[model samples]
Target: MGFHGIAKAVCRALTVRQDGPSLYDVCDPLLLKYQGGDPHLGKFYRTALGNPALRPLLRRTGLPALKDAERLTRLRAALTAARDDAAPDWTAIGTPVAELMDDIDVRHPQPPAAKVTARAPAMADIDRAIRVCGAHLLRSFARNGFIPTYAAFNLLGDADISGREMLMALTGLNARGYKNSTLLFALARIFIAHSPARALINPPWRGIAEPMWEPVQIRHRSAYYDAFFTEALLGFVETGLASSDQAGAARRAISDMVEFCLKTSAEEVPSHDGSTVNVITALAPGPHPRFSRFFAQIKQDLGFGIYVPDCDTTACAFSAATQAGADDPILDQPLVDFYRGYQVRAGANEPRVTVPLNDHIDYEGGVVTWIDNLNGDRPYGNDLDPTLNLDILEVSFRNLKRWKIIETPQRLQTVHRIIAFQRRLVESGAFKNPRSHIYYLPELYSAYFGRCYAAFVALPLAAQRIIDPGNVFALIRARVLGYVKDELIAHEMNPFDAALALMALAHLNAEIATFTPALHCIVQNLGEGGRRGPYKAYEWNKMKTPTRILVGGPEVTSAFALMSLALARRRMAHS
Candidate 1:
């Protein structure tokens, strides 16, 4: 047999254990004729294949051990199959309606001997902090008006994805749903944040505008965050934050974002009818390599780019465009159809296709993260995230209401299904556990949930009729008060977390005292010169690994701080 044949037989013979990473994972590239993609593993595999001594050892002993291990894994899974497939008790998580109104305080008890040192920030301090933060944000804006987002190695890495920083800053500023008139200066500073991204959509601003500085890992300027930028800009427009000319610019940016989403579909997949269709239903986190033909070749050869579209970005795009009055009927059906097709209905399909699963069936009705070109064989694409599903619920409702799109039975069914999924997911307290979410920290998840709930509730009573809010408000309360509030009182949260907490509390209309600590946290963290905070605001997960990328240094943190402090000021003045 040839070397390729021997490699395939060896891989097949290799044993994979149910409990851990296996030789199969290591040898998959050889069997599949694709590169492993992991740099460390790639090096190891090359050595194993080339070294004659290693090859002899692998053939003589390694293959049999691998075969035995695979057999054991299969046998163990078969033994637990019956117990694992049983559905979780969804009703058991439901709280009594009466109890939902009752406040459950879980504040940590402080020692009596300890003096009360942390005071609510004074009004003047808050105002000054806001000004300082706004100034910091303005200064952080690159020449092209983009805010830098960094990741942490030992400290924060270099400007990783500025688009994300801009989005988070804008989201924090508008968290209270305040009019743009009140935040004119801050808004003006951010008005051009989207321009660099928009320029990427229709380029040749090459000489005129400096491209946003990003690490080589981030290929496209849009890079999975255009929807977020689109939504942020649209928020400015709706809140009268943008002037006529600015609004026109915002709309143009929004158009570019939506068009980019539609045109970029990773690759085509075979439709149910056997004809191939561009899998354009969702927006991908891109490394599209549109700027250079060289990187495109690398992407094709090494599979370095994230080619699959995700539901979260797609939902953001839909809501942003719909609200911005960019009506595109062509996008509607495929999007609805993609969700319907990819939404999980049974056991984790294609186990060990990417990550290993131990026969759990809890993720029914939640849309999988990726809409890939795998047709029915989407093993890697079937991961479920409650946070992303909640995003879908929030954006879908907004889009439907804005366009007055006639909802299909399938569409309504999807709405009900994901809502059910979210309710059960939250009520079971799984949502509170950081392990349950793939991409977000628990506090971040709760903050987003609060923001989403507030937006949904604000939809006019007529528009709110589409999906029942059910116990979402109660869930938010439980999460914020029972869990998040305790964490705030006990721990020193970063400015980003504090800002998120402050806005969520504001949304809840909780007593000013409930979030004053968060406000104080933001105020006290202001670095000398008040240009930025002493801390970082956000840290993004790199592919859900332990290694986190710290996003937004002092400047980004200050942006969030400025917004939070401004909101606190407004609330305090009223009080």
Candidate 2:
């Protein structure tokens, strides 16, 4: 079908904003003609929701939030609403349905810092390690400021600009008072250089340039990376990391990221019987080009095509934007809009999806990875993950309390539900299960969980009570510490994992002795040529392929190592 036909079909499907969009619309005979009646309804579902691996991560019972009778009635009402409300717009734009789907395949489509004092035996050694790692990172920094050393897809090409590792190293160095150093200045300049102030194709955000991380190999700009880079730069400015010359550029880039986050958010209106219906808001990853380029080359690089709105990116964006110092209160809308919206709960309308290598598990309360339920290769973004939920909690709660924003009932309810959900994950041993959180390596997840938990507890008692009501943080803390012990007991962690564990311990303020094992792990794994040892931080399914892609390299490993040693040293001296 052509654009007109597709527009008409969408208009018909969304007869009323109250009833939500209908997947049944894809079953219409007219729509079926486009796919040659291949029973594409299920494909549409899978595409929009997720592949088989992500199917089970959603709430199983009471899905879709509409039964046959109710669905049909709503569909009919939607048709009526289309006839009444959207008819004029369709007539004016003058679009036809059959013309829209002729040749369209809709599938496969943050941080901050600070500084402190230091002191001197074990401390001296830790300081030396930090310097060593810092030098390794500095040596690996591309003249362009990109950390090309971060290997992805099992290859570390000079063209690969790994935003994740770049930001990690930048912040880690800044934490050690390297913010004003020459290396950081060069890196900050790179961020300033890549941020495009020009207008974008999709969502048409203006007034600020979006921070686009163009990984030469992937050849696409990532919204997640954009928000992440923005958040990191914001932290740099906040902590006096960015030099005076770069601070203005950093602020402008942050404004760009905030704009991108707000623009990329998708609004889902659920069908409801009550007089008031709340719209669900969440952030989606983007190639966000204009309509003409939407389907030119379908690259399924991250399993679920391109349009899935995930909690990880959402949380990152929310946290970044909340701290971005925007004058508009609307920037905080996600805080209010995300209430019980995308999370797994009773009566949730989201589609269920699963994760591989650990699929047999069953649990709920954590937020699903994807929140958007549109008809992409993965819609209804299903699946709960410990790290993703923790991310959401860290950002949402911190933002809410940081700004002292008054809580509406919906916002309040969302916070409580997320806490309860995490409690369930922790108490049920889901938090410790590698299969439960498929995105990160086991040790890496432990590190992230510990760090996020530390941040959560650092909040006021009233805020901490949200999770501490059932001693949830206590259990979570124990689980994190237990994992640290396990890593030490095995005494076999790679340098990256060792560094990650050390960072977690430092974040948790564990005793100085707890730092010994991880420090040894780092020392033992040191590369032969005076380089940091090689390690893989995490892996994910490549788009359209079954192959799992690994991402990490010596630069990234050293980055973490630097942060870990630096943090451990500082924390110990303070203690």
Candidate 3:
């Protein structure tokens, strides 16, 4: 049976609720329908299905399993047999996901920095720290229960502890939905080595596993990124038995993620002008129950929140250069109200344009504009003219005032100070900045100072673009996203940065699907040497170290390298 017939049966069973069909009920039938599902695929669930927790709730659809080493070997053999019956086609498949090459000519690919640079001592320290972190993160992954861990893979002698830690860190971040690490090279190796074809139909993580990151939200942006989730999404769409069912589920997952990213502004504002900032307002819950409650609690805890300008920036703007259309909206709501509010604030004679917050466009949701003179219900939106009631902004801000984070402004101040202190290291001219790019101060101080400058410069450029209050969430979310994204890009766009970015994005709102492949790439590209056995990669730092030894000081260089490792480890733990 096609997925249609099978899905219908499942849906029908659900409607009446008379003991939903068991995995055994659906598995064999679906397998038979999909053409004698591989016995290996059957065994994966046949054993697991016995568990009560997985019974009907998470059953097997008889998809093939491509997990570990031996299973993959069998799966490949099966593919060989199946392809023999049909004409084999070459030049069809693209590069393998991870390029699982055993005993292959192993060459440690260059780090992104290797492509360009004249190193100063401080930069050298930073680079060394980055590389060492990359190595350690991969090693940490081995310890975390992944198959490719150092010891499990007998990599103790071949690969160093650094490589393993980098791999593990990237993988975990990828799991959360990001590809920001330098570890992608190692991850790609895993993809080249394995396939998750069978695992797609009934994903293990289900909803959480569904879209881990926003799709095509950025376009063909990162060359190093993996489109694994995109591929998986496409697979489901194309092979789905019922266009309405499986596709519907996928859409639901997407909807949940997008909705979780947005929260309705608000309904009322208090008359602060008459008294002490009497800002008591209620904020709507977010899409995800717990997250929404947490958000609401934060708002209530804050006692006051700033009203940022609301705007939508999820759609693309037409550029004569690209010759693309004005762009379809990627957000999930109407942004008319926000735009109308903007028109009103700008002193347009009257609210000329009205847009609905309910329309299918996303709006920015952070930083409400503080209009001390604004208040009142003022018939916000009518069907004829949709517009966001600036009243909602009032309510939103009041709720935010109650947020727990803002309540502890002292903590925020402390963190800010720490970031500033770390940023001022540039003052001593520690790292040679030909363009004075590192303006903050020195060391960590310089890094964060530059980061702050980047964020400040970017804010209004993104914030000012907001046209509607409904799309406010989309804009600021994009801002927060852009901030970290640029940071990752600054670091030569490595797997490590990707992980951190993913974590930040997930915290801001919903997770998406683009992170997995990027993670797989990191796992596959891990550097080799220890027990994986003398892969013959030259020491990049060692070359510079010996040079520094004669020109500068040996003891100092040795201490620097050691410090680099220590710093890298600390960074890995934090990131």
In order of lDDT, best first, we have: 1, 2, 3
Evaluation by TM-score, superior candidate among 1 and 2: 1
Candidate 3, residues 124-187: lDDT per residue as tens digits? 4434433443333223223421101010011111121123323322232211111111122232
Q: Which sections of candidate 1 miss by over 4 Å?
A: 1-119, 122-220, 230-303, 323-325, 328-334, 347-361, 374-381, 402-407, 462-466, 469-473, 527-537, 545-575
C-alpha TM-scores of all predictions: 0.57, 0.54, 0.20
- Residue 371 lDDT (model 2): 47
**C-alpha lDDT of all candidate models, in order:** 0.46, 0.44, 0.25
What local lDDT does model 3 show for residue 530?
Answer: 33
Name the TM-score of candidate 1: 0.57
Q: lDDT of candidate 3?
A: 0.25
- Cα deviation at 228, candidate 2, in Å, is 5.0
Best by lDDT: 1
Query: Order of candidates by TM-score, top first?
Result: 1, 2, 3
lDDT of 3 at 53: 32
Global Cα RMSD, each model: 17.5, 19.0, 25.9
TM-score of 3: 0.20
lDDT of 1 by residue, 1-575 (tens): 34565455445333322333233332333322333332322332333222343333233222122245654354233212211224312122111111111221111112122123356878877766665554444343323234344333211111121223222222222111111111111211121121121121122211110122222332333323445455444444444434586567656656765666556533466544455544443324434323246545543332233344566766666655555666666445445555666676655543312221211335777776765565343323335667777677767666664434335666777777777777777677776565466555566566667656766777666555656646554665666566656554345554566776776666556678777667766777667323234444344333321112223344445544554555566677788
